[model samples]
Target chain A: MRFRTRRGIEVVAVADLSLDVADREFISIVGPSGCGKSTLLRVVAGLVRPTTGDVRLDGRRVEGPGADRGMVFQSYTLFPWLTVQGNVEFGLRIKGMAATERTRLAQDYIEMIGLRDFANHYPKELSGGMMQRVAIARALANDPEVLLMDEPFGALDAQTRIIMQELLVNLWQRTPKTIVFVTHDIDEALFLSDRVYIMTARPGQIKQVLNVALPRPRSLEVTTSPVFVDLKRTVLSSIREESLKAISLTGTE
Target chain B: MAESNTLRPIYRLGDDLRPHEPIPRSHYLIIAAASTLSLLALWAGLSYTGIVQPTYFLPTPGQVLATASRMLLDGTLAVNAWASIFVIVTGWAVATVMAVPLGILMGSFKFFEALFEPVVNFVRYLPVSAMIPLLILYIGLGVEEKVAVIFIGTFFQLILLVADVAAHVPKDLLDSAYTLGASRRRVVTRVLIPATLPGVMDNLRITIGWAWTYLIVAELVAADKGLGIMILESQRGLRTDRIFVGLVTIGLLGFCSDYIFKMVHRVALPWSPRIR
Candidate 1:
């Protein structure tokens, strides 16, 4: 979709992009910088309405943000004012669940994220990985049908990012909630996703959909596997080609 | 990012940069006491040496203390302090009651913001001291007039402060709130209000200090029975010690209220940076 800059220049963020996300499937969208992976996730999350086309969830047109889809942004977006428990319980609280019930539910997710000790701690008090874990728990506490994460580990240091990816994979294994994970890291996409969608830069479109045939219960070890390495090479080359095309089109590099 | 991986020990010792690990409370108390005592010592030294004609310009600390005791014993200090506190609290409360909602509305809705931003901006720049004569003309130099003056001094500035704070509520936070199935009202209440509250408390604390600034201004053309009036009366009699008492009284009161505000902020916003 085209967006006008403050200077009124038309920038097409995404165009001619169409894909069906399967129920209970873990899908990752990987692309170069400025690709519309995040925008696509936002569309499904019903945050920004598409200018022309419609996003359908369960055969119903996505109208606006709803309880069924939850999103975690790249930044540590946990409300800095709230304790970890408070942040986790935010969605359940908004859903009008009774205090005791929401508290009980939020505690479970907090425990799942292995932050039960820090449940009463504020977001500012936690490290980036810990904060992102809370963000994940917060999203899942509402029991949404789909979790839309936009490079949620992008801000974390490399070690933290790997740990977060493993944690996410473990969580998905246990709950198997439908997840639309968007990232620029091809290794991350290969390590965690059931299927990886590679998109072109700028007016982003899905260039390829590579189904990761790696075994279940994937770990950090998967990234070093020959199969994972081959998939990564293919994904990396496609992304590099598209990035070069984008640079040529924009004529600024 | 990789630099953090060096085996350098990560010190968890509380410092200014890390709000999560605040410096201990006793240390803060020590610092505060030391600063207060040092200032008092400086004043006492200057007066004892007759640096600026102690009897006329700067009263000796002992003489000021004697005057304070006299006022306290005669109950004049209590009456005037209470009156000033009453006006300040009432005027500040009134300003908060009105400014918070209006500011939130202006911050939340573009239409209200567009409608009120220019007007509020225009009025906020107009000094409250400049409006004293006009306020007296309109309200006639009564207690109501003083309260009105304090309110006017605080309200417009608070509105703008609150609006700016509310406007800056993180966009990611608001979007997350929306995706959580929060209605517009809940987004304002649950997210925006809570997120902006620490800043609001800080702003209110500052504005209350500003109210004290306009206290003397408010009393300049007004009736009696306030600390400002007490200072004015003392000035007429050339009672430098009494003037010092009044000044000290206002300062002490402001310090007490600031401490209370800090306490309230601590209780209300546990996530915020604490006293160090």
Candidate 2:
């Protein structure tokens, strides 16, 4: 696939790559800020208009925002007026699902996110981590085939970020959805991704795709393992080299 | 271990209590009573010394109370008060209905905002009282005229308020809603409207008070019945006591209505910051 900006700047100019994501593979795209990771995710979600590329889901051209792709944003953007249960059920309500079904499904997802006790509490009442959990649950409640998370844990504190990362890994393991996570954090990418695509600085292109052959059911302990360390080193060096090149280019300009 | 256990006394009976906590209710009551007593004593002292004549200018508090009791017994005071409140509430309702939708539309769409904002600004700058003669000319000196006066006073105020609230709906929230598959209608209803509700309620409070002021101005014309009319009639007849009674009624009614609206706001928007 290839794409260019409306201003005629080529963004992802040459990309003949195929990722054979199993029904629910976890893939992470890691690069510096403004490297089009978010743009690629939006293109995959069919939210952005790619100038020269087409996204195919089961070989069908992706049309528009649909149930197949659910997005969890960086900020916990739960509706402030709605209670935890209400926010989770928003998608279902829009689908014109019956009241009983909506309630049942919302309750089930609320429990899944460990927010059953806060079902009646408004979004403002929850902490940042709790609110993000609600956002994640809201996206997943629709049972989408692909879950696109755009720096979902980017705003949380370090301790909270690690906890949320563990929770997301567990959720992905249980549900088995094709997950495309975008982040600028190398360690997070290596920790969470089955495959990591290293991207160049904007206008971005794929620099390298590193397969993280680390064992499944990965834990924080794996972060210290030799394999994880080697992968992290590889990703870090790739990003550093791209950033230095970008800096030199800016210096010349 | 002992030092840590006794690090600091968490409770101190004499010094830890906040100034407002220990005797808030009693302190307020005492201050109010003292102020009232001093005012009454001053009035009595002036009257006794003949420094000011009560018959022409200031009426004694007793005289004002007696006049209020008489009107109450005759059912006239109650009727006039109810009439004034009814007119103000109706005008407020009409003004709110007209302003909110227009405000939301103007706030949401940039083109509509540009087209109508200048007209709104022009109308808002015009003194509401200046419209009295025109309203009277068009509607006659009837309930319609008074309601129109009240509506004109409140409508523009509410329009600016609601528009501001609608315009300030957070961009991040709207974007999230779109990504969640919410349509344009859903974004307006779910994301924008609810986010702007606190601002709308705040404007409603201000407009409600303005409505009362307009009611008084409206009655200054030819109305035979309302608190303002009663005040005007008493002034013409040199009945200071009756005038005092009407003025007090207006103050008390306005205060009570504002209090009621505050309670309603608290109930409706539970997520909003609590009033201190």
Candidate 3:
């Protein structure tokens, strides 16, 4: 996919990128900054149409953003004018669900995210971690078949990120949906994903795909396991070399 | 932990600091009361000391208060106050009706923005006061003329401001809404409108002040009733006390309307940030 910026300069973002995510699979894409990881996610979410090639969901060509897919951005994208309940109800309300049903559904997701007490609280009243949880609940309440998260916990503190990661894993288990998570954090990608697709820097294409054979119901302690460490070591060294090449080519380091 | 918190480099100077956390409502009330009393005291002192020389130029606070009461008793105050309120509210409401949709269009679509932006910018720069003669020629000396004055004064500036506010509705939120199955119209009515509401309310609050600022110009052209007319009549009669009464009444009315707008903002948009 290529994009022309406001300055009218054409830049190739993604090239020769194709991957089929199995039903109910959890996939993560990790790459250096400006590696078009987000661009790839946007294509799936149908927020950005690729310059060439088509994105198909359920054997149908993806035309635009639809309810079949939900997205959680890196930044806190909860509508500031909406309370927790209001935000969670947004998609359901748009879908013309009855108010009582919408409220019940929204409340279910809010409780899932552990923010039942703050159902009436506005986004401004929430901490960053809490707000991201609202964003997640909002996306999930739609009952979308696929959830596209663009570094959802990247804005969080380290401690909060870990807690959020665990909470996400738990939520994923309970709600079995295809999730395509994009992040730059190798550890986060390793911890949460069944398959981690690492991309080359700029004009991004999948360089490697690491299958994490880590056991289910994994905890933070699994991060210290030798198998996890070995995988991390291999991924890191490969990515480090790609990252160095990226910096040297761009001369932006 | 306490020592570390205290010793940490404090970056509390900027407006982003949530320094005044959860102060009681009554604390604000006390501060407001004290501030008003000090200003009143200052006004009284200025007049009593004869520093504001000649009673004709500046009436004493007591004189103004007495005149205000007398006007109230004679029913002139009520009549004129209602007249002023009617025109301001009518003009402001009309401006809001016209500006909001136009602003949204201008903000959302580049084509519309390019078409209207230059014209609006140019017209806004032309003084509303300067356009009074032309407005009178077109709309005449009735309340319509005055309403036109206030409308012209606020509408242009408001459209521009509302457009800016609408444009600032975060892109991510819009994208998120679209991904959530909202149609284009749904995006506008559900996402865009509600998201920009608090900011638009803020814009309305400020432009309402501008509406009041244009009231004197509106009434000065030709009007038998209203605070501006009251002030003009007083000035002609050399009744500085009554003029002071008119001025104070306008100030008091402006303050009350501001309070009303704020109350509306709070009640209508409870999800917005609390003032405290």
Q: What DockQ, on C-alphas, does every prediction get?
A: 0.63, 0.43, 0.69
Worst 10 residues of 3 chain A by lDDT: A74-83
TM-score on alpha carbons, each prediction: 0.90, 0.79, 0.90
lDDT of 1: 0.87
**What is the DockQ of the complex in model 2?**
0.43
**Best candidate according to DockQ:** 3
Tens digits of per-residue lDDT, candidate 2, B75-109, equal 99999998898889899999999999899888888
lDDT of 3 by residue, A1-253 (tens): 8888999989899998898999999999998788999999899999899999888887899998999999999987888878899999999988899999999999999999999999998888889999999999889889998999999999999999999999999999999899999998899999999999999988898999999999998899999999899989988987887899889988985
Candidates in descending TM-score order:
3, 1, 2
- Which is the leading candidate under TM-score? 3
Tens-digit lDDT track of model 1 for A1-253: 6677899988789998998989999999988888888888888888887877888888988899998998999987898878999999888987789999999999999999999899999887889899999999999888889899999999999999988999998888877789999988888888889899999888988899999999988777877899999998999899999989888887886
Model 3, docking class: medium
**C-alpha RMSD over true interface residues, each candidate:** 1.3, 2.0, 1.2
How many clashing residue pairs are found in candidate 1?
Answer: 1
Can you list the residue pairs that collide in candidate 2?
none
DockQ: the better of candidates 2 and 3:
3
* Count of steric clashes across candidates, in order: 1, 0, 0
